[model samples]
Target: MKKLLIIGFLSLFFAPLAQAQLGIKGGLNVAELTGREGESSSYKAFYHVGVFYQANIIGPLSIQPEVQYSLQGGNLKSAYTNYDSQLHYLTVPILAKLTVGPVFIEAGPQFGVLLNANQSGNLQVGFTEDGQPAYGNESRPATSNFKRGDFSVVGGVGLKLASNFSLGGRLVAGLNDINDAKNLTGINDPRLQNRVFQVYAAFQFGDGRR
Candidate 1:
C-alpha cells in the first residue's frame, strides 16, 4: 500500500513539471505550538522562501509542488518563565488548486524535515522571600528533544493578479507530535505540534497565467 501511494504521488508531482510555470515566493509566518496542556503559547513571527512549479490540469484545476525553507515555533509562557522556541524546517507541499476568475483555493499535504531548533530568553530560577520572581537570561540548543520530521496539512486562498504576480494566505497545521523526548525533565508538554499562518507574494517567470 505504501509503495503504491508513493508511486501515485510521484507521478502526480512530476507529470506536470515539464510544462509548469516556475515561480519564486517569499512570505511571513505567524507561527505557534499547539497542544500544550497548561502553558500558554503565542504566535512568533518568522519567514519562508521557496520555489514552486504550477501546471494546469484541467479547465479550472491545477497542481502545484513547492519546496520551502520555513522558520516556525512559538513564544511559550508558563508560570515561572517565558521563552521563544525557534524551529527551522525544509518543507514540501503538493497542492491541488481550483481557480475561478481571479481567485484560487488550494489545499494539500505538507512534509517537513527539521533542520535546527533553539530556545532563547529568561528562565525563572527562584522566588524571593517577598514573593517576586527571579530570572536569569539563558540561550541554549533545544534540538535534542524534538523529532526530525513533521507532517502537516495546508489550505489557502489567493488572488491571481495580471499574469505573473499573485498573493495568498495559508494555514498549516501539524498532524503529529514533534516532541521526541518523552522522558526529558522540565518539558511543558509531551506532545507539541506546529501551527502557522502564512501570507505570501509569488512571481512567476512566464508570459501567461495558467
Candidate 2:
C-alpha cells in the first residue's frame, strides 16, 4: 500500500513539470521552536535556496512544486545559559496558487528531510567568589536527538514585479514534534516544533508565466 501510494504521489508530482515554468528562489528565514513550556525561545535568522516548477492549471490558478535547502531552528535562553539550535533540512512544498492582477496567494503542504542538527552557545560554568557568573563556549552534534522528518504547512502572498521577477513572504508551520531525545534540558513538552517566517525573491524563466 505504501509503495503504491508513493508511486501515485510521484506521478502526480512530476506530471505537470513538462509544461511548467522553472524558477530559482532564495530567501531569509526567521525561525523558532514552539510547543515547549517554561523556556524562552527566540527566532534565529537563516537562509534557504531552491528551485521550483509552476504550471497554470486554469485561469488565475496554478500549481507549484519546490525543492529547497533550508537552515532553521531557534535560540533558547535560560537563567544562566543560552543555546542556539541549528537544524538543516531539504524541504519540498507543493503549492496551489491563485493570481489576481499582479498579486498572488499560495498555500501548500511541505515535506522536509532533516540533514543535520547542531547546538552552540554559552554555558554557565560557575560563579566567581564575588558572585559574578562565569561561562564557557560549547558546540556539539545534535542530530541524534531530533527526528529525521518534518511536515509543515505553508502560506504566503507575493507580487509579480515584472515578467520574470517577483517577491514574496511566507510562513511555515511545522505539524510534528522534532524532538527525539530521552533526556534533554530546557525542553518540556508538547515537544518541539518549528515555526518560520520567510521573505524571498524569485526569478522565473521559460516564457515567464509563473
Candidate 3:
C-alpha cells in the first residue's frame, strides 16, 4: 500500500512537465500607432520574426513563452507636419493557451526593449493660410527621442495540422505610451501607442506535436 501511494504521487507530479513542447516561428507584422488627438494616423507594413515554446501544465492547457523582433510606430499627418516614425524592438511575451483538439487560442502580456528608431518626412516652415507647406523636404536622423521599453497585450488563435504545422493570426496592442515626445515643439503629448496585427506559420519539432 505504501509503495503504491508513492508511485501515484510521483506520476501526478511529473505528468505536466513531461508534456512540454517547443517550436520555431516567423511572421509578418502590419503595424501602426494610434491615439494622438486631433491628428490623422495610418498603419505601416513591417516584418516580425521569432521563436516560441510551450510548457503544458495540465490537461489541454499550457503556458507559452515567445521571443521576437518587432517593428512598431506609425505615420501621422497634422497641419504642420507629415512623417513616419519607425521603431524597432526586441520583445518577449508570456502567454496562456487553451488547446482543444486541432485548435488553440492564447492571450498574454508582452515586454519589449527598444533597439533603434528614426524619423523622416516633411515639415512646414511658415504659417499656413491654405494648408500648404511653405518649406518642405524635412527629415530627422536616427535618434532615441522615445522611451526604451514597451508593454503590450496579445491574443491569437491557431489551427494545428498533421501534428506538425500550425497557422495563426494575432493582435497586439500597446498598454503603455511609446512616445516620449522629448524637447520637440508642436508635437502633442501622449502622442503615440503601438498596434499590430500578425500572421504566422510555425513547425513543431521532436515528437511532431506540441
Task: Return the top candidate by TM-score.
Answer: 1
Ranking of all predicted structures according to lDDT, beginning with the best and ending with the worst: 2, 1, 3
State each model's CA lDDT, in order.
Answer: 0.89, 0.89, 0.82
The candidate with the higher TM-score, 1 or 3, is 1
Query: What is candidate 2's lDDT per residue for 82-141, written digit by digit as tens?
Result: 889999999999999998989999999999999999989985555678777687788888
Candidate 1 lDDT, tens digit per residue, 95-145?
Answer: 999989889999999999999998888765556777776777798888976
What TM-score would each prediction reach against the true structure? 0.84, 0.83, 0.83
Q: Top lDDT: which candidate number?
A: 2
TM-score, cand. 2: 0.83
Model 3 lDDT tens row, 83-127: 887889999999999989999999999999989998878754455
Over 4 Å off, model 1: 1-18, 124-135, 182-188
Better of 2 and 3 by lDDT: 2
List the RMSD of every prediction in angstroms: 6.5, 6.8, 4.0
Q: Which 10-residue span in candidate 1 carries the lowest summed lDDT?
A: 181-190
Candidate 3 scores a C-alpha RMSD against the true structure in Å of 4.0
